[model samples]
Target: MDMIVWAGAVLSLAGVAGLVWCILYVMRLRRKALDDATMRSRMQKAVLVNFAALAVSTLGLMMVVIGIFLS
Candidate 1:
């Protein structure tokens, strides 16, 4: 229950939220009637966000593990 663990937990939660957002966004995107160009553009943007969220979640889990070991 160190502060680092708490921080990590928060970071992980935020990443999860972002991931959920990406899911919802993709769902909405699928429902849209935009052309291929616009869809691809939006999908690329979503990919970036998805990767960022994954990275953050991984970093958070790493931080939690490191904190536990250090504690």
Candidate 2:
């Protein structure tokens, strides 16, 4: 159970890091002043990563809860 909790913490951290990366990526992209079509294309990719990060974070939280309950 303790291991599970620790693993969950790590996963949560990774997800947070990914989210930060996405934010930075978008900010940089905005500064590039690309065309609308290109910007939209890049943004679509970022949105997918953002959603994946959110899902990973949610899974980590669930794991933590389950670990705690089991312990």
Q: What is the C-alpha RMSD of each candidate to the true structure, in Å?
A: 1.0, 0.6
lDDT of 2: 0.92
For candidate 2, lDDT tens digit of each residue in 1-71?
99999888888888898899999999999899799999999999999999999888888888888899999
If scored against the real structure, what TM-score would every candidate get? 0.95, 0.96
Highest TM-score against the true fold, candidate: 2
What does candidate 1's lDDT look like per residue over 1-71, in tens digits? 59989899889998999899999999999998999999999999999999999999988998899889999
User: What lDDT does the true structure give each of the candidates?
Assistant: 0.94, 0.92
Q: Once superposed on the true structure, which residue ranges of model 2 sit more than 4 Å away at CA?
A: none
Residue 69 error for model 1, in Å? 1.0
Inter-residue clash pairs, candidate 1: none
| Model 1 stretches with alpha carbons more than 4 Å out | none
